[model samples]
Target: MSNKDIITLLHGAGGSYMHSLIKNVFMKLNDNYGEVGLEMLDDAAVINDTVISTDSFIVRPIFFKGGDIGRLSVSGTVNDIAMMGGNPIALSLAIVMEEGFPLSDLEKIVDSIKKTAEEADVHIVTGDTKVMEKGSLDKIIINTSGIGNRPPQLDYNINTLRKNRQPSRWLVPTNLRPGDKIIVSGTIGDHEISILSSREGIGFEANVKSDVAPLNKLMLKLLEVGGIADAKDPTRGGLADLLNDWSEKSGLGIYIKEEDIPVREEVRAAVEFLGMDILELSNEGKVVLAVSPEYEKDVLEELHSDPLGKYATTIGEVRKDISGVIMETVIGGQRYVGRPIGSPVPRIC
Candidate 1:
C-alpha cells in the first residue's frame, strides 16, 4: 500500500508527522468561529474569552509509577487550558471500556480522576460511559474536554510585558520574540522513561517516577508575575518538538544550552542504554515558557517558589540570527535540533 493509504502511530505522536496529517487532512474541515481555532494549531481554542481544549488518553499499562491513565487524562486537558492562560473551571469526561473489564479497576480509575480534579480545582460536570466488544478494544480509553475562562492576569502580563508592541488576546506559541528567555519547569524525559521501565520490567536502581501532575495553579502564578510571552507543555514529542513548534510559528531562532536543559541521571542512563534521544522523549508535568528579558528573573523566581517548578531554570533564548532550534553542546559546539518524525517511545501519554 502507498504511504497515504494507511494510518500509522506517528500520525498521533505529536511530532512532524502528526502536524502534517492535521494540516493536510484535518485542516480541510476547519470551520472555527473562535479567535484561536484549528487553523492556528494552538493548545486550545479561544471563543469570546472562553478557552476550550480536548484530549484522549490511551497510555499502555494504564497504571504507571507516578500516576495512572485517569490522572493523565485530567492533567493533560487542564494543562492545555492553562497554556492558553485560562483558568480551568470544568471538564467533560467520556470513558470507553472493553467488555469483561474489571469493575474494581474502573472504580480505582474513577477515584483517581476525582482526586486529580480536586487538585486542579476543576469540576467534572459531565461524563459518559460505553462498553465495547471484548476483542474490539483495549481495557479502557478516556477522553476529556475542558473549558476555562481567560483570566485577567493574562491581559495584565501582555500589557506589562509588551508595552511597545501590539499584544495578542491570549498566549499563543507565535508570540515569541528575539531576546525572550526560555525556561523549563523541571527535568525532562522522566515520564517516558518511567513508562518504559514499567512496561518492560527494567529494574533500574533509581526510582524514576512519571512527573505527572496538574499545573494550572503553577501556570496562573507565572501569569501573575507577568511577561510570559508564550507557554507550552512538552508532551508527546518531548522538548525538541515543543521548541521546534515555537521556532517555526514565530519565524525565529532558538539557542538552547544542552547543559542548561535538565535531565535526571537515571533518565540519561536509560536513554543511552536504549540508544534513544532523550530530547525526543515525552514529559507530562513540565512546561516550557518564553518570557520577556525584563521579566525573566521575576518569572524564574515565581517558578522556583512553586513545587511543580522548583527545579526550573533558563535553558535558552529566542534569537533572530538563525532559523531553527540550535543547541550549544556541553563541549561548546552547536548542532541543530529538529522535530522528530515521531516519538522514540510510543503510547507515551
Candidate 2:
C-alpha cells in the first residue's frame, strides 16, 4: 500500500517490503493502547503484562512433510507470544476455504491444529470459517491470534528472562549488547528445503523434513536458566534477516562462525543445487538467542536438554567493532550478511 497500487508476494516475505508495508499502511491507523503498540516490532505486543500476537498462513500445498498450514498457524502465533517471555494461554482461528476443497483434508488440518495447540499448552477458544467460490483463492488460508501472560514474578534476576533495563517490556532484539554470545536453537534451512523438495519436485533422496514445531517449551527452559539478553525465532527471513535486524536495531555487529552454525547435510545439498544461501531461507521452529557469556554454558545446557534444541549450538557473538552482520567463513575469511530484499520462495508461512 505504498506508492504502488498492487501488493506483491514480497510484501509478505517478512523483509524490507513487508516491513515498509506494515509501517506505511496497516500501522497508519494505529491504536496501540499507549503502552504496547506496533512501534517495538518485536515478536508480540505486551500490554499490562499480557502478550498478544496475530499471524496469517498461506503456505502452498497446504500440507507438507512435517506439518500443514494448520500447525504452522498455531505455532506461528504461539511462538510469537513466547518470544516475548510469555506463556501462551489461548488462540483464535479463522479459515478461508475455496469451494470444492476436500472435507477430508480440512479434517486433517483441523486435527493438526488441535494436536499442535495441545502440545503448546494452549486452546483454540474461538474461530470462524468462510468459503469462497471455486478458483477465487487457494485451497485454504488460516489466520490466528494469540494471547498470553508474563509470569507474575518476571524480573531481571537469573531465574527470569525479562530484561532488568526494560521492565515495561520483555525480551526484544534491541536489548542486545556487545560480548553477548549468539546461539541458534537448532539446524537451519530444514523447513524451507523440505518444502522445496516436496512441493517443487526437487526431491533429495536424503529425506529432509520440515522443522515446523512450537518453541514455547524450549524457550521456557532457557528462560528458567536466565542470562538471556534477547531472543528471536528465525522464520520468514531466515537467520540473515533476523541477525541484520538485530544489528540495525542495536547499532552493533554480529560475528557468526560459519563452521559453528548448524545445517543438515541434506539441506546443504538442496541449497547448493538450488544456488541459494541457507541463511536466506525460512525456518519455522528454530530460535536465535543473544545471551551473556556468563550464562552461555547454562543456557546451552538448558537448550540441549530439550528435544527441539538437541542440536543447539553457540554460533557467534555480538560485537561493537562494526555495524552489521559479519560471518567468519570456514576458510578464515569474513563476509557481510545482508538482508534478503526479495522473496526467494513465496507462500512460505
Candidate 3:
C-alpha cells in the first residue's frame, strides 16, 4: 500500500507517531487551526460557563435502521450539550477504521456527517483518524467531542428549582409537588424499534421509524415560551428511568395516566413482540419536560410549532408524598414503575 494511503502503528505512539497521525490523518479532516492548539491536545473544549460533556459510540452493528454511526456521532454529542442546557456550537470527530474497509462506505459516512451537521447547524471543527490491521478492529469506531456556549435564557441550576421559585427561576424536580404535571415531547420507543428492525432483519408491521433527531431547535423555542421546570433527553433508560430518577432525587411521587402516554401502534407492537417494556426503550430525539400545569399550554404551543413536538402532551404529574413513580392503569389501578436497573439496550445515546 502507498505510504500516503496505508496506516502505520507509529501514528499512535504519541511522539512522532501521534504527530504524523495528526498531520496526515487528522489534519486532512479538520484543517489547521493555529499555534495555540499546537501546545496542547485536550479531550475537552470550552463551550460556555462551566457546561461540557464527552461521549463515545461503539455500537455493535455500527449502522442501524433510522441512523448510522455518522449521524449518531454528531447527534449524540449535540444532545449532550442540549442535556446540559447549552446550545451546540462545534464538534470534533475521530475514527478507528479496520484495514480494507471500502472507500465507498467511508464516503457514505462522511456524507452522513455533513448532512447531520447541516441539519443541526453545528460545525465539525477537528478530528483524528486511524486504521488498524483488518483483524484488529471492527469496520469502524467513532469518537467525538463538542463545545458550545449556553444561552443566558436557560439559566439552569439544580438547586434554584422549587415550588416557590419564579417560573423562570428553575426548580429542581426533587421538590416536585404531588400536583406537578409530567410532560413528554412527541412519541417514544421508535428509535429502539428502528435499531431492532435493522438488526433483526424484521420489517415494521406499519411504518414506525426511529425518533432520532436534534432537539436544539425546538428547545430554543420552548425556552422562549416558558414553563420548563426541568428538561432532559429520554435516551438510554427511556422516560420510565428518567421519571424514577426524578422521583428519587426530589423525595416526591410521580403519577402518570396510562392512556395519556403516547406510543405509536407499530412501536407498541414491536415492543410487545420483543418482550421489551416500552418504558425502558431508548429514544434519540425526544425530550422529557416537567412543567407546572398553568404554563403547560404555552410550553405545548411552543413544542407544536416544531415537527419534533407535534405530539407534545401532558402524560403524568408529580406528587408530594409517594417518593416513587406510579402509572394509573387504563383498567383503573395504579402500579409503581422503577428505573431500569440493567442495560436493556446499550450505546443508545
**lDDT digits (tens) for residues 1-349 of candidate 1:** 9988789989999898999998989898889778998888887999888999999999988998899999999999999999989999999999999999999999999999999999999999999999999999989999999999978888888787667556577888777889999999999999998888878555553478999999999998899999898999999888899999999989999999999989999998988888888789899899999999999899999999888998999999999999899999999999999999988767888
lDDT of each: 0.91, 0.85, 0.70
TM-score of every candidate relative to the true structure: 0.97, 0.94, 0.79
Judge candidate 1 against the unseen true structure and give its global Cα lDDT, from 0 to 1: 0.91
Candidate 3 lDDT over 159-199, as tens digits, reads 23434554422223433555657888988888877777766
Better of 1 and 2 by TM-score: 1
Model 1, residue 30: distance off in Å is: 1.1
Best first by TM-score, ranked: 1, 2, 3
Per-residue error for 160 in candidate 3, Å, reads 12
lDDT of 2 by residue, 237-314 (tens): 899999998998788899999999899988888888888888888999998998878889998888888889999999
Off by over 4 Å in 1: 201-206
